[model samples]
Target: MKTIAILFIAFCSTISFGQTEKESDIVINNSQQDDTYRAGETIHVNAAIQGDLVTAGGKLIINDSIYEDFTAAGGELFLNDYIADDVRVAAGRITVDAEIGDDLVVFAGEVILTENAVVHGNLKCFAGNIEIHGDVMGNLDIKGADILIDGTVKETSKIVGEDITIGSNAKFHKEVQYWSSEGQMDFKDSLVNTEAYFDEDLGEEKSELSLISLGIASFSLWIFYVLSAFLVILVLHALFKNAFSNAVEGLQNNLLKSFGYGLIYLLGIPLLIVLALVVIIGIPIGLFITTIFIFSLLFGHLIAALLLVYYYKQKKEKDWGFWNITFLALGIAIILRLLTIIPFLGILLSVIILSITYGALTLNVIHSKKQFVKT
Candidate 1:
């Protein structure tokens, strides 16, 4: 979880490094870095990363080696290299044809582990469709809609899915436990060294909950959140257009400085508020500060979206009309909300965004006051 949080932070922080031109893709070839961070429309890495590799893009292909942990989120992902540590990926489609020294974790629409793929540690995945034809040296845990495993599992295997198929070539050293509405599946006697357990209760429980209803509810909430964020962005732009622009400009010019100031504000303001609350005479002051902090937290992503759109427009040199800018901001907000669907990642991203947004706003105010004094 800690590693996942770091990856999310890296993903957002590296947005500033994205390509300015649409036709150009971010590529790393035969290079070595302590840590790699990249965000773009398309990213291809052929380098040997000496440290962690974190990336977010439209499509990502890694054909090199990662010496440390690997974390990525994208539309499509292809892994054709070696990871010396754990790997965690979230994508629309994923293909793994590499060797992992540690655990393999994935969240996706479709996942395929080619014959060349090998996981030295456990394999845990959640997806819509999963096909495994590789070798897992440790335990295997999978949850999906359609699952077909023709791989070799050296340890126990646990699976839950709507449709589960174990190919004739599948080999399991330990017990194989599967839960499916179709009930027990026929497996070759020689395939499992131990027992095969069918979990009918799990399927019954799942059916009782009605997955369709749950999905609809969750999707509706997501829509509501996105629309609310869009409305907030429009209101903020309408009321404080100039101030917001200045803050984003300050953020653009001093990203690292803004991050530093943001971190201070995120951590320091709370301490000051707590100190103020300890005094009877300062209770009102503390309450006011608390209210402001709450508002900042509530609209952190909106401000971050504004900054992202502003940077994108500046980089592309596009002249966006008022409504166009708002629409762009809305799009960014939607993307941010989607990213938050990943567990643990959302909290970390929220913190980073809140810090940066408030930091930029504070800087803009300071700069404005200084200018007023000069005048």
Candidate 2:
């Protein structure tokens, strides 16, 4: 427990607020031999974990020595310690200034591997930009907007991004294959034989307006198909009106989690693939997984919406008919899809609506309406 306490203190000292923080606010500190920490806001750690360090926070900073694995979720993270096991994190910005004994997998807005840092195993990263000035003993895989490697990569490396810079001092013991916006990879400085592949779908630039128009057309087609299908399903399931009604209510209440699940599915697939490829013979399975993910994303969203509607109607005190709940959910899903195409504001709106819709639905299905209402 000493190590856990130390970890807790280290994290708490960096946070700006106290216990009076918002409902979403969370803070954790673990200073013990076996660190166990969980939070919803910000976390600072200075502990040694004999077991895994699992956390779900808005921001995380670790400055201790951990003996086990660490998993965290946040908007920003700064890790400046020694981790004996693998590290997995999802944040907006991630800065590493320490040593990792195993793999380092991260998703963030920006990831910086500072000088003197060392990664003993593979490094898989996805972000807006990746700046590496450390040592990687195994392969360094990345996907980002801009990627700069100014240190040593002991083994192989693969990257996909908009811009890449392999510093003069950069050393690669094995092959380094990459893809970028230029349609080809270049070893700007002196280096061993490097292979750069181009994106197979790369083509001459088309007008942005053309793509936007096509997107609209696709949306319209989806709307038509959805409406037709919902009507057919509703008519067939008329006898199960109570059950369908309950599902709808559930969806309305728990829409948030469903939306979050969808977003996770979107960002998690590529990262998982990168990690899997590091293990020998896992490459084929990883690629197949990615293909399945791509094919299921839209279908998953649609199903989530449908499930929500069904729960809502069935759980209501005054039961609703199948058509009532089905139409409402279909309408909401169609609107959400349409809104997702509007750019920045649209994205935010879609998240909000989807979250609400799914959240309500989840609540309806998981618990009695009276019990849920009491909470």
Candidate 3:
């Protein structure tokens, strides 16, 4: 289960990378793509986007309008434009300086909503430090280390943090509830609409229901992953059936070499990335390699399963056809996921097998490319 969670996080990282940081300093006049997939070191926009805006980078500054939803993740994100739909973000530092017609959800180290910021719907924030000096017409939910609200919230608010502060101009026209560790609740009466509720042990309390909910959530997430892997297998099989078959064959023929190389590659990459970071010129190369590594982690398990299925069929009386590969792949995926429920051994085996598969796939691609060059 933990393994699956890690893969999911890695996969989401890839998606986030594709959306943000992938495209740097892109400017759109009045055009719209079906969807925005961009990542780069820094992003600066002075135009409008029609479709869903997805971006990641070191820094993002938008000064235009988005017709659809906006999603971004990076080191720093600053939006001074109008978003027609919801805004979802995960970043190191984020600041919204414009209006969002829908919800604004952010997970960041530090989040600030400047006075120019306005949210027509709910504002949900999870951060290390959050200060809202803007206007939210809907409910506000904040979970962080420190929170300061000087904004006007027309609806209720729920806050959970270590330190919480409400500015004199902060307006909560409805009910306000908070959970804080400091237990300091001295505020002017005019700023709060109703008597606020503060409890030190509010969110920290654990109950049987909470455990059951967590169990259910974990099971659901595992099932979702199985389904996603099956989908990926089907798509890859359909598009690259021959290539996948060759990769499976390569893994079977060179299992020991692949495993050794996988171990070395896994351990060596971080060191290389660190060295690259020390040399600013190698930053792009480092990021590209990191992206490839993330993709390998995502596809490694499925590829290993495929290779396993192929290895078993080799010992069988008859091999399955292309059409049957999907079913075979799905069966293997289910068994592997079920094995994840066991204690540490199951996940450990998965890691080793996936690493071997990643190495095999890398070698197979290199060999193919070399053959093409030779021809």
Candidate 4:
């Protein structure tokens, strides 16, 4: 599950890069496009997209139509338009008043499908609270804490929740299966055209042994991550010794400057990739950038460890050779890995270290390019 989550974050990061520090906090899209990618504090889409639409923001409002899939992650999301294909979203709160041509998949805290909404395909959701008063032409699969369904499910329905209520207006054309701690719920015969099933054991908690096994698995995965990261850093040092040295020198010379540049690269590159993805011809470039960005994020901490070791060596006036530096970097990486176990502080420290490391690296790269041009 952790690995899956990590991969999901990496994938989202690739597409969620948005405007630079100087750009507006809000993004407004009013033009047509083959594929659109946007990220900001707030996003408003009022155009007809010929292809897909992908966005990440704090608040997102879509008042137009999408010809293909629509994927988004944000705080508050409102869809008041038409989606030609599937809709996948993860957010805090989601309200849908549009027409979905395909499936609707959502992971949210609160979800509402107003009466004006119509889904041509299945509805799959995991939320804290869900209210569906619209029409679903396909099956309904939902899991939540509180659920109220007054909608029409044309096919089978499976719902799992703490509190489930089927409104008087609810109509099920097929079988409905539900699981809750309170047991099977009583539904009016008129509301269902088929049967209903309740599996009591499905909602039960896992056994102690299962939890222990899960803990062991998670620990093993962490160990693997640490070892792999160490190996990757060693390989990077071996293959790009000169380039790495130059970046360390740059960091030693101007720590603040490198950090500023790193901050820009961290934020600006994503925005550039988003823009590139908006154009059909620039799709390749966007994908390439995404790959490199993911790599940088994955190995960022190890890189930071290396930078720390080099900085320490410089401060101590030590002339450590390649092998000694390698050992020092390994030790630093282990210490960093351990420090990251302190909850919030660990995460904050990791981000700070990553920023510094990447900043130095980006500075060196730019300098190298300039020197190449001059030569």
The numbered model that scores best in TM-score is 3
lDDT digits (tens) for residues 164-238 of candidate 1: 888877888998878986888787753655888998766664454343322224676556456445544654444
Cα lDDT tens digits, model 2, 1-375, are 122222322332222221112434443345566657555455677656677886655567887878889877655688989999999876557889999999998756688999968999999886677899999999988877778889888888877767788887787777766677776666765355654445443222212223432235666556545643353233223222333345454455555565665455456767898898888799987866665554343333344455555554456654655346556767755665566678898767655554443344334444554654688
The clash count of every prediction, one per candidate, is 0, 56, 14, 1
- 236-319 per-residue lDDT for model 4 (tens digits): 444344555667778888899887887887889899999999999999989877777766765676777777877787778798
Please state the error at residue 53 of candidate 1 in Å. Answer: 0.2
Residues 265-340 of candidate 3 have per-residue lDDT tens digits of 7778778877887888999878766766655655666766776676676646346875476668778866765664
Provide the overall lDDT of each model, using Cα atoms, as 2-decimal numbers.
0.75, 0.61, 0.69, 0.74
Q: Rank the candidates by lDDT, best first.
A: 1, 4, 3, 2
| Higher-scoring candidate on lDDT, 3 or 4 | 4
List TM-scores for all candidates, in order.
Answer: 0.55, 0.51, 0.59, 0.54
lDDT of 4 at 167: 90
Look at candidate 2 and tell me the lDDT of residue 34.
65
- Models ranked on TM-score: 3, 1, 4, 2
Candidate 3 residues lying further than 4 Å off, grouped into runs, are 1-25, 33-35, 39-41, 205-258, 261-339, 353-375
CA RMSD of all predictions:
16.7, 17.4, 9.4, 15.8
Best by lDDT, which number?
1
Worst 10 residues of 3 by lDDT: 15-24
